[model samples]
Target: MATSTPYSAPLDNEKFLYKLVIQLLIFCQGSHRLLEPHLLAIGAKLRSGANSQELLSELQAVSKTLVHISKQAKQDVNVGEGDGAALQNNYLLERLDELLNDAEVPLRFQHQTSLLKQRVRANLSEDSYKKVIDSAITLLLNIKDYSVSEQKGIDVFLGDLSDRLDELGQDVEIAGQANREMIDNRENLNTEIHRQVGSLKDSTQAAEELDILKNQTAEYLDRLLEQLLEHKQIEDERQRDAQEKIELMTKKLQELETETETLRVKLKIEHDKALSDSLTGLPNRLAYNNRAEMELKRWKRYRAPLSLIIWDIDFFKRINDTYGHKSGDKTLALVAQLLLNNCRETDFVARYGGEEFVMLMPNTHAFQALEMAENTRKMIQSCGFNSNGENVNLTISCGISDFNESDLHDDVFVRADQALYQSKQNGRNRCTVFAA
Candidate 1:
C-alpha cells in the first residue's frame, strides 16, 4: 500500500480503466440517443459528469426514470375528462370476461370477444389493439341501435297516453257543462212551481173575499155573482195553465234525471279506462299506485302483513319478434286473465308495464306470496300457448316481498323488483322471495 501512493497506479491498470470508461461513455451516448425525448435532463447530467461517484449517481437516476416510465405506461389511461373517465385495464378485462359469460349477448358477438380476449391476454400487440377497437365500435353501434328502438317505443307509448288524457279531459269538461245545464233547468223548474203555487193561493183568497162580500152586502149580490162567475172562469183558466206547467216541469225533471244517469255511466267508463290497461284489460300503473298507497296506509294502521309480487313474462320480446305484435298483445291478455283467475278476491293485480305485472296481497306473508307465485308460474308454463300453428311455450318469472316496519311503498316495490331480477338471473319461469 505504501508503494502505490494516493493517485498512482500501474500502467496496465490505468489503460484498462481508461478503456472501460470510454466503453461506458459510448454505451451512455447510445442510450441517450434511444431515450433522449424522455430522459433529457438525466442524459445531460450523465454527459456532464466524469467522476466515478457522479457517474454512478446519474446512472442510478436514469434507471429509476426508465423504470417509472415503464410502470406508468402499463397503468390505466385517462380516457376522458369527466365521469367514468379512467379506462382501467383491469376493468376492461373484467368486462370482457362478463361478455363471454353472459348468455344474453349474441353468440357471434361473444365469440368475437372470446377470441379477442384470448389474443389480448397472450400479447397486447398492434393486431390485438385493432381487434379491440373494432369490436368495441361494433358493440357500441349495436347498443345505439337498441337504444333508439327503445326510445321509439317509449315515444309511441307517451303519445298514446297523451291522446287518452286529452280524450278524458274533453269528456270531463262535457260532463261538467251538462251538470251546469241540469242545475239551471232545476232552478227554472223550481221557480215555475213556486209561481203556480202562488197563483193557486191568490185564487183561494179572492174566492174567500167574494164569499165575505156576499154575506155582508146582499144588495150588490147580482153584481158580485157576475164578477164571481168571471173570476171562476179566470181561475179555471189559471189552473189549467198551472197544470200544464207542472206537467212540463215533471217531464223536464225526468229528462234531466235520465241525462244525469247517462253522464254518470259515461264518467264511470272513462274512469275505468283511465285506470286500466286497454290491451290486457287489467289495472294499470296508475291503479297500482293508488292501491299501493291505500295498502301502505292500512299496513301502517293495522300492522297487517302485506306482500307484493312482481311478475314478468320471460322472452316476451322474442314472442313479439317471432310471432307478431298482435300475438304479443294476445299473450299479455291471456297472462293477465290467468293472474286474475288465480288471485284471491282480496289480492290486487295490475299491469305494471309492458310484460310486467304487479300483485298486492293483503294480510299475506312473503312465503305465501312466493307459493302463489310459483303456482302461477307453473300455470303459465303449462298454458300451452300457440302462435301460427306452432306451439309457443310461455313462462313467467316472479319476485315477492312483504311489507316491513318503516317500509315505504316504493321500498317494497324496489325489493320486489330486485327479487324479480334475481329470478330472471337464476333462470326464467321461477320465483324468488326477498329476505328483507
Candidate 2:
C-alpha cells in the first residue's frame, strides 16, 4: 500500500507556490506597464548623446533595483497588500531619486528637479508620487538636449583625424614609389655604361680606321656621359621631390599626433567635468562610487581600518528657500571648502548628492572618522556665510560607519546612510555612529 499522503503534499504545495509566483509576476508586469509612460517621458529628456548614456545607465540600475524589490516582496507571502505595495513603491521612488539625482542632471533641469526631489521625499500617497513622477517627466521633456551637438563635435574631430591619417598614408606610399624609381634609374644607367664598354675590342688595325673607331668611341662616350648626366639630374629631382614629400608627411603627422593628443586631453577634461559637481567643484556621486569600490577592495585585502562619513548641510533646503539658489550654492561651496580643509591627504572627500558629502577614510576607524566628522561639523557651523547680505550660520549632520570584512561597500554605505537618518531624526546638527 502507498503511504498516506499529507493534505499539504509536495505536489499541492508546489501548485500553490506556482500560482503565487504567477500572481506576483503578473502584478509586477502590470505595475511596470503603468509606469512605462513615465519612463518613456524621462527617456525623452535624454535626447542628447552626452546625457543619454549616463541617464540610461541610471535607469537600468533603477529598473534592476525595482525588480529586486518586487521579487523580495513576492517571497514574503505574509506581507499585507497595502504595506507591501507602499513599501515597494517607496523603495522604488527612493532608489529612482538616487539614480535620477539632480546633481548629475544637466544644469538647465536642476532647478525643476530640485523642487521635484523635495516632493518625492515628502510624505505623499502613491498617487501623489505618480504625479511628481509625471511632472518630472514633463520638465525633462521641455529641456533641450545639448549632448547631440556635443556628440557632433566629437564626430567632426574623429572625421578630421581619419582624413589626416589617409593623407599621411598616401604621402608615405608616394614617397616610397619615388624612392624606388630613383633606384631603378641608377641601375639602368650603370647597365648601359657596362654594355658600351664591353663592346670595345683590342685588335691591330690601320691608323685611319683606328682613328674612325676612336671618334665613334668618343661620340658614344659623350652620348653616354650626357645620358648619365640627364639620369643623374632626373634622379636628383626625384630624390628632392621624395624628400619634400617625406618632410611634409612628417610635419603633418606631427600635427595630427599633437591634435590627437589635444583631443584626448580635452575628452579627459570633459569626462572629469561630467563626474564632478559643478556647484561644489567636488567629485560627484559617480566618482565617489568608483573610489569607494577601490577603497573597499583595499580594506578587504589588507584588513585595514576603513571608515565612511556621510554628512549633509542642516536645513539646506531651508537655506535654498530663504536666500535663493545662488546663496544656497555659496553655502554649499563654503561647506565643501571646510570639508576639504579638514580632511587628511589620504582621506577622499566627495559631494555625494545635493547637500550631502561623503568622506572615505582609509586607515581610520569609526572613532577616528567620528572625530574628523565632528571637527568638520563644527568648522562648518562656525563659518559665517554672508548670503544675499544676510548672515547665515551653517551646521551639518554626520553619520560614521566602519567597514567589516563580511560587508560589501554598498552594505557599509547603507549602514552609514542609516546612521545619518538616525542623526536627522534625533536632531539636525550632530554626528551619529552606526551601532551594528
Which candidate has the top score in TM-score?
2
lDDT of 2 by residue, 106-174 (tens): 656678777876786667786797898788677655543455666788899899889889998888888
Q: How many residue pairs clash in each candidate?
A: 0, 0
Q: Looking at model 2, report the run of 10 residues with the lowest lDDT sum.
A: 199-208
Candidate 1 per-residue lDDT over residues 76-119, each given as its tens digit: 33323322522355346445533432212332344655565455
Model 1: worst 10 consecutive residues (lDDT sum)? 98-107
Instruction: Give Cα-based local distance difference scores for all models.
Output: 0.71, 0.78
Q: Candidate 1: where are CA atoms >4 Å away?
A: 1-217, 220-231
Please give the RMSD to the true structure for each candidate, in Å.
15.5, 21.4
**Candidate 1 structure lDDT:** 0.71
Estimate TM-scores for all models. 0.50, 0.62
